[model samples]
Target: MSEKFRAYLIVSVGLACLFVTSGVGYYGFAVLNTPVGDEFEWSRGLIMWAFAFFFIVRGLVAPFIGRITDRFGSKKIIICGALTAAFGHFLLSQVQNIWHFVLLYGLVGVGMSGMAIIPVSSVISIWFDEDRGRALGIATTGVGLGGFVLSPVLAGFVIPGFGWRMAYIFLGLVVLALIPLVMIGIKEKPKNYSNDKEDDFKSPDFEKNDVRGVFSNLSFWMIVVAFFLTSMSNTGILQNHVDFLTTTGGFKLQVIGASLGGVGIASTFGKLGFGWLSDKIRAKYCTLLSFIFQAVSIIILLNASTLWMVWIYALLMGLGVGGWAPLSSVLISKNFGLTSYGGIYGIVSSALCIGTGIGPLIGGYMHDLTSSYYQAFLFLLVLYAIAIPAILITTLKN
Candidate 1:
């Protein structure tokens, strides 16, 4: 194979591995929340706070991680992230107190900042331009695939057989195993690689601006704001769907959980399909479609009474939510070149993380205060409507 093709394969594999690790590590909480709450006699809100805390830590650490990737390169940062994630899972496996849960999950959050989409997508952005959106979409599809395949399987089988702690141990070991693959296979774009005797691909022209530069760009701010709102709405659904079904819709916990897995499966295809579509059309339009789809899903979820209704809502929501991941990165790459792409993406991702951190907390809190998630779902619908305008404004020339 040519060096360019080989580079794409290596970077794509690295992104897939990183997504699998971070998805499982970060989302393990969503599946295990009931088990943890039951074991500790904690309120669901309290258990969800752990996930919130994780996002907060991820948001705070993301910019630094991006700066490090920009300055030093992605290799060391990815390896360090993988190992740190392994350690965090190890600590989680042995947790005895709420504080232990907080501390361990905080570390996991930091590790997620290191291991998640920003670094992986940055590397892929460096490797391919013509097919960047599709490449990123394929790489990130790992997260949805992992969740689709692992969440139900782990919750139904592993946790039942070995308990949640042992499940954590197994997850930690699996993530640790990827470290060697990342180290051996992953490489930054070759210093010598070029296109057509012109150095354009070798060192693409872009301003080497910091996070402040990103803040000054109206497009960047619009993307960030829209993403924040979308993330908040998305997280509310993902984190609370099971509870919402069980408490208000009168469904069994297992049924609700499995249906969420169905959402995951739908999301896997959504990510890939929307990503390819972004390459064909404008990414901003794809993003707008995703938000609209998600808003409709949320409305459907609010009124869902039968299992079939829940399943349909899950699939639609999954598609919309899944599409957002790749489309967001593609838009960023189109607006800003690879120069400081990691840092700029990281800042936008920090906004997303912040929204995610607050979503579940507010969702759970609303349930606690109102005795239902109806208010939260309605709130999400409004946010989605707001996001449509935000996204439209992003497409306007500044």
Candidate 2:
């Protein structure tokens, strides 16, 4: 097959996989939160913790997943993950206890380990070398699009009418439906494709990657730490996004869904826009711009009183969310090279999981305590500010 055609298929598979995973796993949970909490008589913090654990397990398993993908292939691993995710989501429909929710979400996390950004970016890195950022931007846009299409349906019609259990089953169906795309489209690039020499990750530095000194590098640590902080803000805000609207702004569920829908639409543009810009400029600067967008959104949320304010928050935060994702793979490839890309990227992915894992609990706890997300949002703003310096201070040389 032509590299061009194969590359297109690869990217299409990635988009579908990422889209379903984020929709059902991340944002779908957003829709399910209030309903699930109400049904189980659980506190917001208690329920959000399950999400926190999912991300934590996803991160921790990433290195192993990355290694496993390298040995066998992402195709089988991803398919298995997809199947596991479907089963886990189906079980979520039958959750009768808190322990079941926690355990089943962990199963979903295992599936995420095989499908999330690290694995998706790793595969993309092996295919499109030159427009890596742009390709990833386009592919990662699936995440936003999923939320765009699903949030409204789940929040507006499904959850309100059929209840949250059916929502999980619906998401499981979505995952199963994507399997053909995965099986047909996802395949590793040939090792020595004549057409791919100028593309793919090994083009510039066509040598085996060494991770011996990765831990001792300051810039590597900076990438880790900086993204950790960024993930805290991003993940925390995402977990409680709809709740903030309903609780603080007094918006209805469908109204909150509309705001999230806007976020999804804007995020699509943000991913493409910033991704293209990253190819033209330093990625870190573009990252800084995303940070600014998110910070402003958080501040707006703190004072959000109407639908317009909610939309404003959603748009800015969506841009930040969408833009921030592609840059991670771009930065990691640029800084660490593709030789140990999976391992290095796994560490970074885990850092993101760690940050996200903790953020929701903290955000939920804050809301539970103060009856508002204002203080937590403010703290996220501070973390964004801290990340600016953290990224800028790192010396990429070495």
Candidate 3:
């Protein structure tokens, strides 16, 4: 490898690692959502809430990992996370009761906490300077790409062929395999840039790396609140996407995989294209563009009665969501400075987890209550409308 592009190698391997996490951990729940319920003869809302609890626990545990990243860095944390996730998946494969689902997923959540967003984003910020946003966009694209590759591969092939039980075991092995690959690839920047004034966000008060003090900043709270709602609304739709499509379109499993995969495919472009723009323009503006796109995607989804329409909604929605994921790191770096990137990002990530937990739980119950997703999607649109002003008014110009 060349001397200058070592960071790129780190980013590449991290992307693949993220792809595995996303495929099995994040999107995997969606693929398994309905089938698990059917096998257990439980209400969809009950199991979906278990998935929601997983994220809540993950969000709560993430800050602790952030503190570890701040003190010791990410290598050990990530390796442990991968190992725990493998074990969690193995345990999940053996679950025979509702508490098994919730408890084992909580264990999965703890593993997720170890492989937290704070550690990964902290490394990216340390490694790349001028191209931070774009590099991050590329790195985080694993989430989408994993969905593209793993979702269909799981839903279309694995789940149907081997049953959900074996699918869990298969995912456990994938995580176990990714452990050494992550350790081999990830590294802190050779030089510490934390003290550099030039690298700092324009916020003068943020030079201290004070976790408690961050909550006092209006801009920081803006990020927390906005992402919280964003996570809640988006994950609701995402966790339920396969079931929604299967019901509405009566499509085959492979076709359903393709539709979900479309989100992943479109998200790759979204991250690459918009992340490039965030470098050229303002990161927050790129964020606004994403919010607009996500809002439009949901509005379109409300009327999606056909398979093609679902694909269109997935494309637009994925793009919008994609922008937010990478931009959070860039925008946080812009607004808060990198003195304590991991902790601040951890808190934001935690808020994101909370929202992620809320979305699917609410969606599941709403589906149970009204036999429709209309209420949940409508709830998100309104939240989007509210967020535009929130983002617009929060000036990064400190």
Identify the candidate with maximal TM-score. 3
lDDT, candidate 3, residue 242?
A: 67
What is candidate 3's lDDT per residue for 1-398, written digit by digit as tens? 55357788878877877788788888888788668889889897898878888999989987788878877877888888888888999999989999989989989888877774677777777777788888888988988888888877787799999999999999999888877777778777655444475344555444445577687778778878888888888888888766776775576766767777788888888988887888888877888888888888888777877778888898998898888768888877766766677788888889999899989898889889999877876886788877777777676752
**Candidate 2: which stretches are off by over 4 Å?**
191-208
Q: What is the C-alpha RMSD of each candidate to the true structure, in Å?
A: 2.9, 2.9, 1.9
Q: What lDDT does candidate 1 reach at residue 319?
A: 91
Candidate 3, residue 173: CA error in Å?
Answer: 0.9
How does residue 180 of candidate 1 score in lDDT? Answer: 81
Q: How many residue pairs clash in each candidate at the backbone level?
A: 0, 1, 0
TM per candidate: 0.93, 0.92, 0.95
TM-score comparison, 1 vs 2, better candidate: 1
Give the residue spans of candidate 3 off by over 4 A. Answer: 192-194, 198-200, 204-207, 248-254
Tens-digit lDDT track of model 1 for 1-398: 66677676766665567556545765677877778779989886777788888898898888889888987777778878878888898889888878788778889888767878878887777777777778877887887777876676678799999999998887788778777877776787767644333123221223334455555567678888999999988897789888888888999987887787788778878888998898888788888999988999988899998989998899999899888768888877666656777888888888888899889988998888898889987887799877889998764221
The Cα local distance difference test for each model comes to 0.79, 0.81, 0.81
Q: Which segments of candidate 1 are over 4 A away from where they belong?
A: 194-211, 396-398
The TM-score obtained by model 1 is 0.93
Clashes of 2: 1
- Deviation (Å) of 333 in candidate 1: 1.3
Q: Candidate 2, after superposition: displacement of residue 323 in Å?
A: 1.6
